[model samples]
Target: MTWRLVRYELAMIRRNRHAWWTLLTLAALALLSFANLSLEAARANADKREVAAAERERWLGQGEKDPHSAAHYSIFAFKLSPTLATLDSGIEPFVGQSVWLEAHHQNDMLDRPQQKASLLQRAGLASPAGLILTFAPLVAFLLAFVAVAQDRERGTMRLALGASAHPRTIVRAKTLAIWGGMAALLVLPLAALALMVAAIGGRLDTDILLRVMAWTVLMSAYLALLAGIGIVVSLRAPNARIALVLLFALWIAMALVLPRTASSAVDALRPLPSSQAVRQQMLDEAAAYWTAEDTKRHQAQLLARYGVARLEDIPNARMAELDMVERHSHQVFDRVLGALYGRVADQDRLFSGLGFLSPTVAAQSLSASVAGSDFSHHHHFIVSAERYRRDLVNAMNADGMAHRADSNERHINDVRLWSAIPEFTYPEPTLGGTSGTAIPALVALALWLLAVTFLVDRAARRLMP
Candidate 1:
């Protein structure tokens, strides 16, 4: 009987021209977004790799020069894109592509994707995960909002009840039909999209396949929750119009407003200091720590320690002072940047805390984490880059000290020495790392779905017998 009811609902939906059109329009839009993303991902990765290779060759081919000069000619550490990011570019647009690893200083990554976008692209840039979370639920709601209430209004509900059919069973069939319809419209198109991406050499490896499947399951759950909400509204409202109005209001609150409000609240509660300001403070500290008087004192100490009368007689004198300055600068950067890292982590945690109030927040968080564009993944890459910079700079400084001599001696090394420095390599984060960061949001979403399902069942039972 339930199967027959479900089939009846499906057959009725097949006759709704407007619903079918809506599905078509949505699928078209999704394909456009994915197409841009697939090409862009391939191009961006290619450009980054190409530029990195050129830079590496440039470094190795830079002819013999002073170690200090070579240190200044720093290489860039390029971050490659993870395949999942093509589906949902989370925080990637906001962050930079590469960090310049140089001697004697730490650098923030530079050249974000957002930096290259025009005013219009910035305004309407679409994310697949974002689009699905925002609009798919609305599509589901539009289909199911009238599922029960319209039957009641038209008096078919009387026939349904008179047939000795349980209201719960009737509601279940309606919900199942609604969910299946939307899944067919949304999920099937996306599955086709995945295949197309693979055909275009998007590397549908095991990891990427796993992420796509996970994203699909998440979308399914979110849509199911929305469908249940719509059905519940339909069961409780006096008529279809009222059910739609209520559902629309809920959708606006959940999809449009809450996510922004939560993020803004986190920023307000734990404001971060400006990066430029922190850099300035580090500069001032370095200046104060290495004043003229301090340099003179250090020079005298080096002279006394070496038992030399004049600066020219002391070997490695300049290198010793550089060594001292480098150590002090490192300490300053570590202290200032460490504080900034802490503030960012705090903000991320606060935003994660608000996931229960807004499933969109949870969904975005999960998508970003899985795609390796979240704060955690980016931070790890940044930390790794900085570590590499430190090692590279320290090696150069050591070479400086080794080649140091009196003022007349000029220190230079063979260009082949550059090849000895290992290329910067950033490891792709593992699935476990993604899961760790996404777990909180995942849990929040599960709780929401469970809560909605419980309410829906209760509402279904309360419908007229």
Candidate 2:
């Protein structure tokens, strides 16, 4: 009987011309956006490779330069986009794609797309994930908001109840039908587009396939929850008109207002210092720590360690001072920059907590984490690049120390030392690392679905003809 009712509801939806048009329009929009973003990701990745190769050649071609000069002439580390970035760009556009790994100073990443975007592009653009989060709920409301109210208005609901149809069963069947229709219309189309984007970007792999599956399942659950909410609101509303208005208002609050408000609140609660301010702070600390007195103290320590009475007696004593300064700068960066990054993590956690109020927050968090475009993934690349820079600079200093030269002489090295430093390759973002953020979001989504399902069942028991 439930199966029959579900089939009947699905047939009604199939016959609704307006619903079909809306779903088709949504699918078309998603596909177009998917294609655009996928091409962009492909281009960005290609640029990353090209730049990396050119940078390497440039470094190696710098013939017979001082090791310190080579360190100063450091390479740029460009982060390649993950395949899933085509689906949800997350923070990629706002954050720069590449960092300059130079000596004595950690340079900011450059080439932020947002800075280059035109007004029209900024205002009109929507990602596949953005469309799903904003428009899919509206579509779900359109599909299910009148399911029971129209029946009750036309007297068929009373007829069915009098003819021995269970209200809970009817409600459950309608919920299933609504969820199935939504998944078929929105989820399946977007999932297909995501896979196509990955393939076109030449990154279709086992991990990507698994991530796509997880994305599909997550979206399906979200749709189900929305469908249940729409159905319950229809069941309880006094009339179809009231149900439509209430559902539309609910959609506005959930999809538009809450997310923006939550973000603003998070920013207000934990404001981060600007990048320039942080950089200046690091420079000031370095300046204060590398004073003349400190350098003299460091030189004395080196002399004592080498069992030499005078600075002239120590070989490569200047290299030792430079090395000590480099090491001290590392501590300064950690103390200042580390605090800034810690605040970002705190903000993310606070935003995740806001997921209880809006499922969009939870959905976005999970999507970005799976896509490897989240701040955590970006931070990992940064940490790795910094470590490489440290190794490169230290290696250069060590080379200068090893080559026995007079205090007045400069140590010049060839391509061998430059070639000795390994290229910077970012580690793949694992599911395990994402689990810390993803698990909380998954739980939030589950709690929301379960809560809405319970509401639907309870409302159905009191559902009037």
Candidate 3:
């Protein structure tokens, strides 16, 4: 009987010309979005590799210069997007995509896509993920808000109940029917997305498969939650119009308002200091710590270690001194930057705490984390880049100290030394380390699912003829 009822509901939707039109339009959008994603991801990946290669060539091609001067003219650390990140950029667009690894100054990410995009694109409707997060629920709500209420108004609900189908059975069938329609709507679009990825030579590896599965699960949960909410509201409301108003209100609260408000609340609760102030402090402290007297002491110590009595007696006197300066800068940068990052992390935790009120937050959080585009993902890139910068600087300095003999007519280091430092490589993120954020979000989504189910069950039991 439940299956029969579910099928009957689905048949009604299939017969609705407007519903078919909406589904067709959504499929078109999804196809276009995924195609763009595949093409852009391929293009972006190629551009990053080209830029990195150019930088490497420039570094190797440079003529005679001091190693320390070369260190000051550092390479840029590019934040390359994961192939799947094109599906949902999460916080990537708003944040910096590259940072200069030059001496004496630690840079935040530069070239935020937000800065380059139009005002319209910044309005949140520019991406398909935005469309899904903001509009899919509305589509579900509109379909299901009248499912039970209108049936009750027309007396078919009583007919079904009097025919020995319990309220629970009928309500469950209605919910299933609505979600099934959404699945039908998604079938073609999802298939097209797969074809698009293949067309662009994107691999369907284990990680990509897992990521796609995770996305599917979250999106299904989201739609099911919305469908259930709509049905519950419909079951209890006196009429269809009021039922829609109530469902729309719920959607707005969860999707639009909470996400924006949570971030604002976090910033207000724990404000971080300005980057310029911290940077200036680091520079001043470094200058104070590496003064002329300190340099004399350091150089004397280097000469003593090498068993030489004169300043020029040691082959790498300046090399050792520059290394000392860099070591000092690393300590200062770590302490100062560590404190600020802690504040940013606190803000993130506070926002996660607010996830208890909105499943959309939880879904989006897990979605981005799974895609490796979250704050943590970007943080790992920055830290890795900084480590590379430090190692690269130390390596060149060490080479200079050992090999820069006054008698070597080639007074300047050449390509051999320049190419000796290995290229910087970023490691992939392990999801096992994502427990910090993932656990909280997963729990929140579970709780919301339980809440939605409980409400639906209660409404089912309370239904009247």
On TM-score, the candidate that comes out on top is: 2
Error of 1 at 281 (Å): 2.1
In model 2, the runs with Cα more than 4 Å from the true position are 118-125, 199-202, 288-294, 304-307
**Model 2, residue 203: what's the lDDT?**
70
C-alpha lDDT (0 to 100) for residue 242 of candidate 3:
85
Which lDDT tens digits does candidate 3 get at residues 318-427?
A: 67667777787789889988888777777666677677878777777776777777777777887888988888788777777776555333235777877887776776
Which segments of model 1 are wrong by more than 4 Å? 1-4, 118-125, 188-206, 287-290, 297-315, 434-438
Lowest lDDT 10-residue stretch of candidate 1: 118-127
Ranking by lDDT: 2, 1, 3
Judge candidate 1 at residue 377 and give its lDDT: 84
lDDT of 2 by residue, 341-393 (tens): 88898887777778888888888787777777778887887888899999999
Estimate the TM-score of every prediction: 0.90, 0.94, 0.90
Candidate 1 residue 241 C-alpha distance from true site, Å: 1.2
Off by over 4 Å in 3: 17-27, 184-199, 287-314, 404-411
Clashes of 3: 0
Worst 10 residues of 2 by lDDT: 117-126
C-alpha lDDT score of every prediction, in listed order: 0.77, 0.81, 0.74
Residue 31 in candidate 1, Cα distance off native in Å: 2.2
